[model samples]
Target: MDITVYRPGELTAADRAAWAHVQSQAVAMGSPQLGNPFLSPGFTFAVAHHHRGVRVAVVREEGEPVAFFPFQRSAAGVGRAIGLGLSDCQGLVHRPGFQWDARELLRACGLAVWEFDHLVEGQKPFEEGATGTYASPVMDVEHGYEAYLGHLRSHSPKFVRTTLAKERKLGRDVGEVRYVHDERDVGALRTLMGWKSAQYRRTGRSDRFARPWIVDLVEHLFHTREESFSGLLSVLYAGDRPIAAHFGMRTPAVLACWFPAYDPQFSKYSPGLVLHLRMAEGAAADGVAHLDLGRGHKEYKESLKTRDLTVSEGWVTRPHPVALGHRARRAPVRALRNAVTAHPVLREPADRFLKRVGRLRAGAR
Candidate 1:
């Protein structure tokens, strides 16, 4: 086997075709997460336009491409999953049964240390490197929208009933309520971004839109239209105004939820949840088999998810002083976070503390 690394933009047409083939073959692996839109070459190329650090490692067997590993490398030789914080799905897209040494792959890319959260499970080479694993909720919509509604009625009847009631109330109090799954209007996308940015600030989290590159990347994705991967903006409108919106990516098989927010004025109606339900229904109608909610803990996720998928978080490092130093600095913090996230007892208090800090920050702003 031969390994070569190239900038995402540098990959030739043939190379990209091969990458897509490997990613498509991943569907046969039986895990819908393996077919995540974020893992597609189109997403990698979209991100590369705004991020110069992005690179792809192509592994070839007997001169035939067999695997593609996408990552972002810093000048200091540290690496991370392609889009890192913004990308919910992370892994090397490889042919089934093919394997390689994670350390060797890192060396081939000139990376001393590689860190990832939200690593899709069943990644053999990186499996042993995982320090922790978490459940990523998903809505199986292959059986169609009606079946999905049936699932909600069975598992979370009250949630579905109340959400529908609120939807009706919103229409009555405001205006006609409607949903558009693939909204092409750029203004709607910007509205979603603005709402999400304010939400991050209110929650005491770093605003992703504050970074010029991420903003640019999102804008680029909004316009990207492709079969293997495409950006989807779903909107729930009250008459002519968009009350709730979501910006996510979708392949034919999977719709990966990314950013979701709603007009605060309509918070009482839980429009965000309504938007998700609409997205699931719309996605199913579009031939998508699943809606990956990504790896996170939230009441909404628990209420809507039909099942869970495992995602791992950890570092894969080559033997080096820099690698050891990086581990020493990050391990403890990661461990503490994992502990808190694993237990509701700790997580609830941590969430409350963050909210308190958020209140202070919002006041100062």
Candidate 2:
């Protein structure tokens, strides 16, 4: 295999075409991460606009590209899956049957250690290094919106009744309720960001939009329109007033749920839940087979999801002094977090601590 590396923006049209070809082939497989829209070449392009560290490794055989590995390399020779903390799924886009060792590939990319948290299952090369597997909730909507509701109704009847009743009440109390599955309004997008930022601060989580690069990346993606991957902004309105909105990415077949927020004034009506229900309907209408809710546990996800997809959290490293040192530094932190998440008894206190910290932060602000 001949390996060539380039910054995303540096890729020639031919390189992009090759990358897209490999990306398309991978989507043919049933795995969610392999088909994740975030892994598309277009994502790399958008990310590169703000993050200069964005890089792609194109593996070619006889001058024909067969695989595309996107990643971020740090100054210390450590590497991370492209959009590591942000992307719900991560992996190399490769043609079926293409074979290579993960360590050799890491060496080719000049990375001492490569870290990933949402690696797709059955990634043979990285499986041995996986510390744990996580279940990412997904709402399989291939059977259409009503079918999805049927699943929800069967599994969580009260949840469905409550949300739908709230939806009806919202329509009755507010002006005519409206749904925009693929909203093009920039103003609504900005509103979503503001709401999301406020939500993060209130919840004691770092606000991603506070970072200029993330803001730029989202804007770049919003303007990027492609069949394989494109930013999708969905909004719910009540008589010309936006109540809830979401900004995510989607392939022709899969929807990757990203940022979602609602006007806190309408919190009582659960407009965010309404937005997702409509999103599933809209996605199904667009022929998307699944809506990947990403990796995490939330009451809403549990109530709405039809099934779960397994992903891995861990690092892959080649033997090197720097790699060993890096591992030594990260192991304990990773161990602690894993332990906390695995046990509910510990998780409750951890959550409470975070909430208290959030309260302090809000008070300070």
Candidate 3:
């Protein structure tokens, strides 16, 4: 086996094709993180544009590509999965049953430590890393929206009942209910961004829309489509006006939920929740079994989750003084995080503080 690293903007068509081939093999691969145009070249471009030390590692056997890893080195020599905050999954992509040692990969990249937060569970490279329990609620949408709703009512009666009632009230009071499963309207994407930016500000969080690359990347994804993974924009309308919208990606088997927003005017109707229920129905019909609600402990997540999986954020360090020092500094922080996350009361304050800090930083920028 031979390993080669390519700088961002240096990936040839062959490289992109090989990467896409590997991505298609991964069962959990979603559009925004892997298949979507924005997440593909866009992520690499963002890292390169910002001088964030992006690189791709290809492991080839007999001149045939076997694995690929996308990473970015920080100023301190720490290598992290590219688009860490924005991407839902992070790790090497390899052929099934083909194994590449994580230690070897890190050494080849000259990284002191390799870190990830949203590694898809069962990706062997991250098996030994410290992990924590997280859940992404999904609704089986194969049998259609109505059937899925019936299942929801059976599984989470109170939540389904309340949400349906709210949805009805919303339509009766505001406008007639309508749903567009695969809306091609670009204007709706802009509306979602506007709503999302406001939601971020109101909740004391950073508005990702401020970043031109992030905004442009999302728009690019909205327009681009692929067979293995495709961008999906779902909208709920009340009297011909879009009240809730979701922008996500779908693979053959999974719908990876990303940005979701709704009109504040329809907040009382819980349009966002209504949009998700509809998304689930659409996903199931499309042969998608999982709706990745993503990592976080929100009220809706709790209500919708059927099972929980574990993910992690930790690093394996090289035998270097700088790496050791980095680990030492991060240990206490990680411990504190674990402790707080284990306790709801402690976690809320920390979440609030982080959100406030994010907002302050965004405002300053």
Estimate the TM-score of every prediction. Answer: 0.97, 0.96, 0.85
Runs in model 2 lying further than 4 Å from the true structure:
29-32
The Cα RMSD of model 1 versus the native structure comes to 1.3
> Which number leads on TM-score?
1
Prediction-by-prediction clash tally = 0, 0, 4
lDDT of 3 by residue, 197-308 (tens): 8888767767889898778767766766766556789999999999999997676666778899999877888898988887777777776766777777788877765555
Off by over 4 Å in 3: 28-51, 131-133, 142-147, 349-365
Worst 10 residues of 2 by lDDT: 24-33
The best candidate in terms of lDDT: 1
Model 1 worst lDDT run, 10 consecutive residues: 25-34
Give the candidates in order of TM-score, highest first.
1, 2, 3
Q: Could you tell me the lDDT of residue 88 within candidate 3?
A: 70
What RMSD, rounded to one decimal, does every model reach? Answer: 1.3, 1.5, 4.0
Task: Mark the regions of model 1 whose C-alpha exceeds 4 Å error after superposition.
Answer: 29-31
Clashing pairs in 1: none
